[model samples]
Structure formats: structure tokens, C-alpha cells
Target: MNAPPQEEATSAARVLVAEDDDAMRAMLVRTLRRAGYTVVEVEDGFELGDYVAMMRGHGGTLAPPDVIVSDVRMPGLNGLEALGRLRAQGVACPVLLLSAFADEETHAEALRLGARQLLDKPVDLDVLKAAVRDAVARG
Candidate 1:
């Protein structure tokens, strides 16, 4: 017997979320969970980098998440910088960034960093869900 498509996809799909705002992070976790994804939360970009490093093995087995959703403006090591570090380290998981204020340069830089999408703050839940699903499917 096989599981339904949605269940099979979401059950094994791990999503790492990096956001500094407590309320916003909670909302994101709740939303992703309701959408059936296995979610991991990190409060800032530094934590995000450390987790990614650990996932890259740290002398263990490689266990990268299916996708990463992050806030562009974190307290330290912002999302774009983290993404650059991940690329430098050869961790190529898809990334989606959230920003309350993204300018033209920011958008261009995000694209250069290979981010899948740059979603604005106060994001629509449905849009976020769809983007995550798309990123997972593409991976």
C-alpha cells in the first residue's frame, strides 16, 4: 500500500525556517505544520548557518533539508550572506527569503545568490505554502 501524494511529499519533506521575530516565526511554523511539512525553526542566520553545517555532516551523514525559508534582515549574518556561505560550502538546497523592505539591489543580490523567491513581509499564507511545495517538488 502507498500513501497519498500529499502525505508522501510533506511527510518526508524537511523545511528549515530562519526568522528573528518570535511572533512571525511561530506563525510560519504553525502554517507549515498545518500544510504537513516537517519544520525546523532557527531564530537567526547564525543558527541557520550552524544547522546547515551540521546537516552537511560535521563528520556525520549528509542530511540537508528540502528547503529553507529565511528572513533577509536578521540580527547577525543576514539571509543573503548565509546563502552565500552555503553556496561557498557547496550546500545547494533551495532558499526562499522574506523581507519587510527589499530594494532593487537586494532583489538582484538575492537572485545572484540563487534564492528561489523573495517573499515580502506579512506574506500571504497560501503563497508561502505554494512556494514551499514548489521548492520541494523541484528538488
Candidate 2:
């Protein structure tokens, strides 16, 4: 047996959701919480930056979230740029990028910049859960 599936995460994993769409962001947060994760929400890149900085300034809240799930396209700054900035700021957390328009080029670039996973939109819940688990495991 491949060691039966894990029922719970090794750590208390929290997730940070960076999505500009109100409904989508809310849905992602709800879905994650239902899967037993703690979640925080950020609407855009600047807000995302502020959250990370706050966490860094103070040790961090809820372990700085084990993973970051961001929408690919957003106002002000997009997900890819956010990921790059986070990396520049020494964020080691795994980031999963989501896009309604996920094409080969996008995936290649995101992986190159260290994104842990990518999900094409409409967001399947089961797959999302599995991806979250794997990303948290990697962390």
C-alpha cells in the first residue's frame, strides 16, 4: 500500500487567496475553509504585498499561510508579477496559479518562476483540494 491517503495535513496549513473578483475570491475562501484550512483574502497585488509585509514584520499570523492561490489576471498587478515580487521578498511558500485563460505559455512562465501548481479555471473542487494538499506537503 502506498501508505493510505492522509486524512489531515502534517501542519495546520493556512491559505492566502489573491483574487480580484468578489464572488470568485469568496468562493475560493469558502471552499478552502470547508476543506479544513484557515484562509485570508487579498484582492490585488498591492494588498497582497501589504499582507506579506505585515506577516514578516510581526513573526506572522497563522504561519504565513502554507500556500498562496492567486488569479492569473488582476488589476494593478497580475498573479505572475505578484509571484515574482513575493519570491524577491524571500517568500518560500508554494503558490498555485489559477486562470480562466491558462495556456501553455502561462504555465511555462509560472513554473519557471517557482509556482507549485497551476489550475485552469472553472476550478474543480476535488482537484483544488488535492493540489492544496500537495503544495502544503511540499512546504
Candidate 3:
């Protein structure tokens, strides 16, 4: 695959996406790929762990991705809790939270845990793409 464009590549990035719904996940992959990013797609927190492990295995001194986009709710593990765990473990990738709608407490917890963006459901694809792009850039 070609390297991501200068304007779109994260400062120290590779984008990771975590969403459970297959259709939504596929749409996200297609959208991000079409936008010139090489996105690492995962279905849930376990898969996220696997991906992160693989990255750490090969990501070397650079560590893992510069940014992550995650769905808020899922079975087995919820995004907020998993990300909090990741933070505790020092993953440090800036995260963007996506959900249909979350309680204020969930929102506050995400921000408190260092989420870079929190988006409601029925997302605007253009905005989602832009948020990912910008978040990656910032990272």
C-alpha cells in the first residue's frame, strides 16, 4: 500500500479502529481507506489487544498507533473501560469515542480518561473522517 498522504498521515501514526458491528466496521474501513489512510480494524477490545500486541511486536520503539477510533458499547468489553485499562497500561494513543448516544457520566469518564473526541450515533461520515484525520495529525 502507498504511504498515507503528507496531509493525512498522523505525526507518528497508524490508525486503529475498534467497532463491533460488522457492517459499521466495514463502512469505517472503507471510508478511512478511501481517504488515504491504512487503518487497522478490530471488532472489540480483545481484538484491539491482539492488534496492539502485534504492533508492539513489530511497532518497535515507535510504540503503537498515534490514534484510535472506538465504538462506546460492545459485549465482552466496553470501549471506555478497555481504553481506561489501556491508559493504565500506558498505551497513550489518543482515542476518539463513537457512540449512538452516551450518558453524561460516560462522556465525562471518556474525557477524563483522555479521549480526544466523543461522537454521537448516526455519525456524519465526512465529519468522522475529518476527526480521524485531525486526531491522527495531532498525534
Writing each residue's lDDT as its tens digit, candidate 3 over 1-139 gives 9978766454335678899999998998888878877778888877876665555534544357667888998765678876776777677778889998698988998999989989888778999888987787666
How well does model 2 score by local distance difference test?
Answer: 0.84
Q: Candidate 2: where is the Cα deviation over 4 Å?
A: 1-11, 57-63
Q: Give TM-scores for every candidate, taking all chains together and pairing residue i with residue i.
A: 0.90, 0.84, 0.82
User: Which of the two, 2 or 3, has more lDDT?
Assistant: 2
Superior by TM-score: candidate 1 or candidate 3: 1
- Give candidate 3 regions above 4 Å deviation: 1-5, 8-13, 53-63
Question: Candidate 2 lDDT, tens digit per residue, 1-139?
Answer: 3643455563357899999889989989998888888788899877876676667624566356789999988886788987887788687889999999989999999999999988999999889888998888777
Candidate 2, pairs of clashing residues: none
Which numbered prediction scores highest in TM-score against the true structure? 1
Backbone clash total, candidate 1: 0
- Clashing pairs for model 1 are none
Worst 10 residues of 2 by lDDT: 3-12
| Candidate 1: segments with Cα more than 4 A from true spot | 1-6, 57-62
lDDT of 1 by residue, 6-92 (tens): 659766899999999999999999999988889999998778877866765344464878999999999877999988877887778
The candidate 1 region of ten consecutive residues with least summed lDDT is 53-62
